[model samples]
Target: MPDITTSAVAPTRLRIPRQRGQAPGTSPSGPILREHIDAMIDLHPGGLTWRRTFPGTLDHIPHARHFTRYLLADSDHRHDAELIAGELSANAVRHTASGRPHGTFIVEINRTTTTITIAVYDCGWGGVPRFGRLFGIDAEYGRGLTIVAALADQVGYEGAEEVGHRVWARMVQPSG
Candidate 1:
């Protein structure tokens, strides 16, 4: 993971274009919705780490998903990582400040020999994520966290909504 120990010199920020007349964060939040998309990618130290700031627009969710897939192309957990990335991006765009006009979200994909970690950092103005599952067909959408937890060997979140919050998932795979 990239270092962000201080706010003065934190993660790199980049601008993403948005369409006019769109109500910014009011777009319906879901998967596979592609609006105009733009983002920035930052390569970190280990060379195995990649961080990007993407516009919180709904269309960018697919961009995030594809970004994770591209990063993990040679890994065994590529598919799982892609799904988790999409879900996390959706949450960031729908529930956090990332969804607002000009708002952005951070996506970091770090891989080691035996484990891969995907972390999504959202603008800290919305509700933080938690593990919640509604057991019903018509219970809206509440299985994202649960799905993430079930797929990743380790899943967790930290930080505050004031500055930002990060939701992460870690997968461990054996080298056959």
Candidate 2:
């Protein structure tokens, strides 16, 4: 396992290219992005879990699912993490329509010898609940963050000024 530390500043934001048609299975752009994410996940102290971000569109869900499967198959499956990916994909589908310019979503995996951290960022208006009290236990509207919080060892949010926001979670890795 590797020791992990956060930089004083976040890593430089990379610009993800948006294609007009569906994403290519072997295109340079998509594979390049996937490699970057894989590298990040692999650097985790335990092992590379998975990290990815795609345009906030309905079409990206399949890509996300594929990536998640690829990552989980290499390790003990962490189904809780999948919930965050699903929520992010669902939000992207609900918010970003065809006429809208491409929106962005980012997923990062940070690892320490004993813990794994997952973070998701999106370029949408920041309106998701940061606190758990905002919704009822049975409320169907907004529970994604709540679920993330429940499943994670820790959970929080980071504001991106006027650009957007990020939701992050840290969870303990299952010991083999």
lDDT of 1 by residue, 13-132 (tens): 222334577677654433321111111111333436789999989999999998998776645688999999999989999999999999999999977655789999999899878876
Summarize candidate 2's per-residue lDDT along 1-176 as a digit string, tens digits.
89966555333233344557846543434223334444665675566545676777767766765555444433333466566556655654454331146666766665544566666666755455354657776777776656767777787777653665666777775542
State each model's CA lDDT, in order: 0.78, 0.58
Q: What number of clashing residue pairs does each candidate have, in the order they appear?
A: 1, 3
- What would the TM-score be for candidate 2 when compared with the true structure? 0.59
* Best candidate (score: lDDT): 1
lDDT of 1 at 155: 89
Please state the error at residue 172 of candidate 1 in Å.
0.2
- Given candidate 2, what's the lDDT at residue 78? 49
> In model 2, what are the clashing residue pairs, if there are any?
2-45, 41-48, 42-48
